[model samples]
Target: MNRTDRLLAIVLELQGKKTIRAEELAARFETSVRTIYRDMQALSEANVPIIGAPGQGYSLMEGYFLPPLSFTASEAVTLLAGAEFVQKKLEPNYGVHAESSKAKIEAVLPEQVRLEAEQVRATMRFFSAREAEGSRRERENMELLRQAMLDKRKIRFHYAKTTGPVLQRESTRVVAPYGLAHIQGAWMLVAACDLRRDIRHFRLSRMSGLEETSDSYELPPDFNLEAYRPRDDRELKVILLADPDIADRVRESDIYYIDAFEEHPDGLQIKLRVRRMEDILYWVLSWGADVTVLEPESLRSRVVKEAQKLLERY
Candidate 1:
């Protein structure tokens, strides 16, 4: 970048961090220490409040602030896109905040850039939240869970398990929440269940009568989420042959189960490793006649049996 842009970026960087060494800035900007020193001198000459000390680092003087900067057309569009995502994917409260934030940003941006960003936002859409069907109570629960996680406090809620098409008996649960994850279009809370003395994943939709408790607990430092995640020990390699017409679409998806794909004269040969045979079976069935199970006799037989049952019903 040019020297003028580098000088401005250095000021922004200092504003972000408490202190930055000349060496660190040099590496970050891909320049020599001498160039950094010169840049720092230039900033100070321009009346930018920068303090420097030996054996320490460079820092912005206390109470020093930069003037509001203009956003480029690209930057404005990027920010608007992120706001649009938060509005569509997150809960109602967050969606409100996202809209408010977008308005504030637009108010400060150049009119031309803001107008361009609006056009970009109009072109995108999200149907995930609609499919998930979040209610007001669920949205409130999500916010409460987030607050509890941040405060390191306990939460109490009545949870019900889905038994077939109906819910079974409801049970009161008190737990210390660790994190929240969106999996397969559902919101799940990962927490340490006090009753079970183990970590469990609770669907937020299944929880009701939520309340935050005064009890606090420290999370174990050694607890790595990767280690705590559920893993399938048994690896089953399965293969499929798909018609060339929809092969590219399947390949573009990059499903987690798929390992590789090879082109055949009539179709695409796909290889996958899955923990459960049913997983691959359902996925292959989704393609209908476009895909055929090529290996693992058990999977092929299961598919044939299911297809025959469907035919019999028809």
Candidate 2:
């Protein structure tokens, strides 16, 4: 980038972080340390209020702030697209804020840039594939859970547990809601389950009659939602041979647990890793004769048994 842009970016970077070493800035901008020193000197001359300590690195003065900056057409389009996603995917409250944000951004943009951004954004669309009823319910649940989390209150809800294609059981749970996450187009709540005495994930679609309780609690200092990752011990391997005609379709389905796909002389070899036989049982059944299980005799037997059951029902 040009020196002017580099200087502006340096100030912005300083504004973001508490302190950064000269070597770090040099690597970030892809320039030599000597050049970075010269740039720092130039910034100081321009009265940018950059403070440098011998051991500590460079930082902006406490009260220093940047003036309003202009956005490029591409940048405006990106922001607008994000706002569009929020409007379509998130709860009603966020949708309103997203709409207002878009309006404010558009109001400040240059006419030419705004028009350009509009043209680009016109080619894109965002919509949920979920049924309207289901989507609305999840959004409502999300809104309630979000408020409960913010207010440091516990929540009570009825959650249904599913095994394979069948509903296993339903139970009421009172949990200290921690955070919400959207994964695979579904909303999940991560919370400390009072009954289980451990952290658990609850799918919003499976939740009903959610209500905030009068009880309040504090978030644990060691718990961080952003860094939390559930451990999965899906060691069961299931291999399938798919007919060439359906191989592409199977791949297109984007099954989350698929480990690898290989070319087989007969057709395609698809390897799957799952936590339980039930995890893949229904999916295998869905393909009918087009997919054949080649390993794990237990899964094969289960598939045959389910197929026999289907035949008996017919």
Candidate 3:
């Protein structure tokens, strides 16, 4: 971390504890003991009430507390910008929390810094890939699932899975909640499904009647999320030619796993190792004429058949 951030962290750490060993602080910050000593001296010189005990450690003088922190104008702007994005794009309740937290921060900031932050907020914006959003019920479900993950507890919920063109089925599931992620502007829960006997990703929006289970689960010792994901058993190598505008959108979205991308005079050529052909076909169709499946005649034929079905429906 930079010097300013490190100094702030040290102060916060000191505020939380009665005493801290110099060695402990050094190890935590990945710095040398000598550097920590220098930092303590610097804090002492700055009129901070740091009392030291020989061979013991250091502590703030009894009843001594620092005043509320003041942020630089640029720092205030950066913080406000991040909070604005979270408020605009994240879970509904989380967005509300962000707004409340931003208000608290602004209340403590200097007038000039607050004014600058407000100006920055007024000018900056963020956009989501999809227009549809999770309802308040979905956000509540996310909080329950998050609590389950934190407590190492199992969760029971009814999951609705799409089985056919116009049908879905709801079934009760008891799962060991592992993690939650925001992918492609939606929330998904990753868990070890007892019914499936494997790790699976379930869309939070599709879950209903969630309940925390009494059972506890032990986390697998060798489980790694990054390693567990990008799992494709039936990998199909395919290619696509995309307009520049659509290629940019693809890069920003989790619509496809791009293995390689090449720029050309006509457009961009994208190579991918995909799992589900139907998902890929629908994603390409969403781009309309901006994207073309250039290889794998089977995929092309499937898209054509789907298009024909659409024509018949119309």
Candidate 4:
């Protein structure tokens, strides 16, 4: 760890309700005891209320603190403002850290501008809701997959295809884990299933769990992820009139060629490509009255067929 992290670790270690000996910090930071003393002196010069006792080591007094890093007054305000916005909109996992940051800024803020910060914080609010992110299990599992990929270990897992039953897969005999990706609303783990194997994509939500083995695997030197995701394999072709309301979103991704549009009575016509019909169908349906599929008789037919079947069930 660098100097900033080393100091934070020292404070955290002390915060856990035990005096940390100078020698202990020296050993932890791989520095000499005299260097640690000099660091302590530096901490004190920065207004850290570190009280030292004979044989009892050192402790920080209440209201005294270690700087996350040295900051100018303007920098502190900017940091606190951004963090305050994040604190309002994000979940505890994200916002709680922002809270600590806010406190750190408040700790060193000068008396004159501190009230201004309070006023700003009192009036400020952040937009955007906390998205449903990965669960702890999901995060741990994903980390394991990353380690396995780097170590070239073989991995196994159960997978459920959308149209089929779940199957217990023993892919380690052939494949090597390559990468994990989250797109749209789903997470996909990509891998090469065998030597010279084509890249395969698996849905994480549909996966039961993962297993890794001691065995290592290798990929062809020329392997690239784009080689696996074929530009042509996108099976569904679509044409639509995009609602002007979501034109900004269209501008965000290269997926839709906006200039290719033709003016319609309602909106701009757009062409879209899809590897699978379901996802794009859901996406289009999300726009409600704003979008209409213009071409590809097969896709329209399938939608109508599904709607008819649903009506009967209803």
Candidate 5:
């Protein structure tokens, strides 16, 4: 951006990495070494504890760590604490780096701050600590799928659906593999399920024997996962207000996450990207009065009719 912004970015770069050469920083920011040297001086004058051999660039002083954006006391507690929490969520092989980095963080925190962090550490609860499925296979299928998706090569896989038996499938549709996401502590794969005639999301653990075919295809120019997704609001636009306390209940439900409620002043308003009125009605009815359905007269009618049925049974 501007010269002032560039100088600060240089300091942040050094703080983030163990060490960086002046020439490397200069090249990255498109500035001369002389300019970088001047920026280093400006940093030092501002009490930014940057120190290293001139040729080696710089390193944050082990004794002096800078909190991101000069954090206030509680803010500092939140940051280091958040990092510690993430240490548990990550798969271990990658978490070694996180662990070593956490060690440095704890080393630099004042004793009181570190103690406060520990108090938090003792109280957090994880529902399921079992090692997740596809803890290993996911990494393998991902790489193969990534190549096939990008080069637009066809893929063959033995995939098992949520409700039925395993099946073999292949198609000429372009495959676009997006990143892996963790949901309910399980890994899910978001990719175009070629035979499904649209973008599809699959649990990685459900896919087996993924094989890339030798043909390459072009992705139709207008394909988007968001647009292709199924909605659960019928043909009507159904918005909903969910109870704040009922959030966990919603998450625990078997409803697919085509779109979901986000908390707002109107409460947690969930949008159903795909229609499933029978399903959504059952979902709302399960919550009782804790959730209020809004919009779409059709959905309201279904809920009302279901409530009548339930009352009759009672």
Candidate 6:
């Protein structure tokens, strides 16, 4: 970016954060520390009210604020689309705020820009993939869990494990709530499980009879929800040949573990990496004869056995 844009961005960054070091600004703007120092000097010369300390970094002066900035039509549309997604996907508490935010953004846009943004927004739509019953339950659980997290309380609930053996299907759990994550169209609670004595992720849809307990707990000092990423140990590689007719459908499904797709004379060659054979057994079964497991003799044997069982049942 040009120096003019960089200077304005630096001031905006300072306005947003409590303080930022020269190195941090340099990294954020993808420039050198020397350039950052020169930019700071230029900003000070322009009377931007940036206060710098020897070791404390830089911050905007108290009560200093930037005037309203204009947005391009595309930018306005992007913000509106984000607001719309939040309204449709998140719980009601956030949905209300998103609606208000959308209104405020629309109020500030130029009439022509607003019209263009609205036209672009109208071309797109957001819809919940979940059923009404599941969506309602998830929303209720999300609000309750959000409150529990804020209050630093433990919660008790009956959780149903959709996978695994039937005997271990359902169990009551008492957990110290940490945070929630929305992954692949589902809400998952990341918590400290009292029973397992470790952090676990529980799907909200599978939870029943959830209630906050009188007990309270403190979050771990080192744990940060925004920085948390579940460990992935998917080493097993499974290859499959999919019928050409169904290739488009498979691509549209957006299966998370699909590693690559290659065109073949017979059909499409699909490469999948997963944690275990069982992790993708059902998905493979769903495609029936259209998808043939080419490797991992174990998965192939399991599929044969399962198909035999189905035949016996019929």
TM-score versus the correct structure, for each prediction: 0.78, 0.88, 0.73, 0.48, 0.45, 0.84
Error of 3 at 313 (Å): 4.4
Q: Candidate 6, which ten residues in sequence have the lowest lDDT sum?
A: 160-169
Give the per-residue lDDT digits (tens) of candidate 6, residues 190-229.
9999999989999898888999999999999999999998
Q: What lDDT score belongs to each candidate, Candidate 1 first? A: 0.84, 0.91, 0.80, 0.66, 0.66, 0.90
Off by over 4 Å in 3: 1-9, 13-35, 41-68, 85-96, 126-134, 150-152, 163-170, 220-234, 243-254, 287-290, 311-314
Which residue pairs collide in model 1, if any? none
Cα lDDT tens digits for candidate 5, 39-110:
888888988887869566677787665445433346555666566555555545545767777787777777
Question: Which digits, one per residue and each the tens of the lDDT, describe model 1 over residues 141-172?
Answer: 89899888889999999998753344557889
Clashing pairs in 5: 230-274, 231-273, 231-274, 231-275, 232-274, 232-275, 232-276, 233-275, 234-275, 261-270
Whose TM-score is higher: candidate 3's or candidate 4's?
3
Global CA lDDT computed for model 3: 0.80
Over 1-314, each residue of candidate 4 has an lDDT whose tens digit, in order, gives 77766766777666765577898889988998998888888777877677888897888786654445555555666888889765653334557899997887787777667776677567756554334333334444666677788888988776555522324343323347777765544457777765445767766655556778778887668777666563356556678877887765654644422235566667677776666665466556556556667778766676677668768999
**Lowest summed lDDT window (length 10), candidate 3:** 128-137
Best by TM-score: 2
Compute the lDDT for candidate 4: 0.66
> What are the clash counts of all predictions, listed in order?
0, 0, 0, 2, 10, 0
Model 2 Cα lDDT, one tens digit per residue, 1-314: 99999999999999999999999999999999999999999999999999999988999999899954878999999999999888877789999999999999999999999999999988988866666766788889989998998899999999999876698799999999999888877889999999999889998988999999999989899989999998777899999999999989998987778999999989999999998888888989899999999999998999999889989999
Instruction: Give candidate 3's error at residue 16 in angstroms.
Output: 8.2
Supply the TM-score for candidate 4: 0.48
Off by over 4 Å in 1: 126-141, 155-175, 181-215, 222-234, 252-254
Q: Which ranges of candidate 2 are over 4 A from the true structure? A: 32-41, 44-54, 61-64, 214-222
Please report how far candidate 1 places residue 313 from its true position, in Å: 3.1
TM-score of 3: 0.73
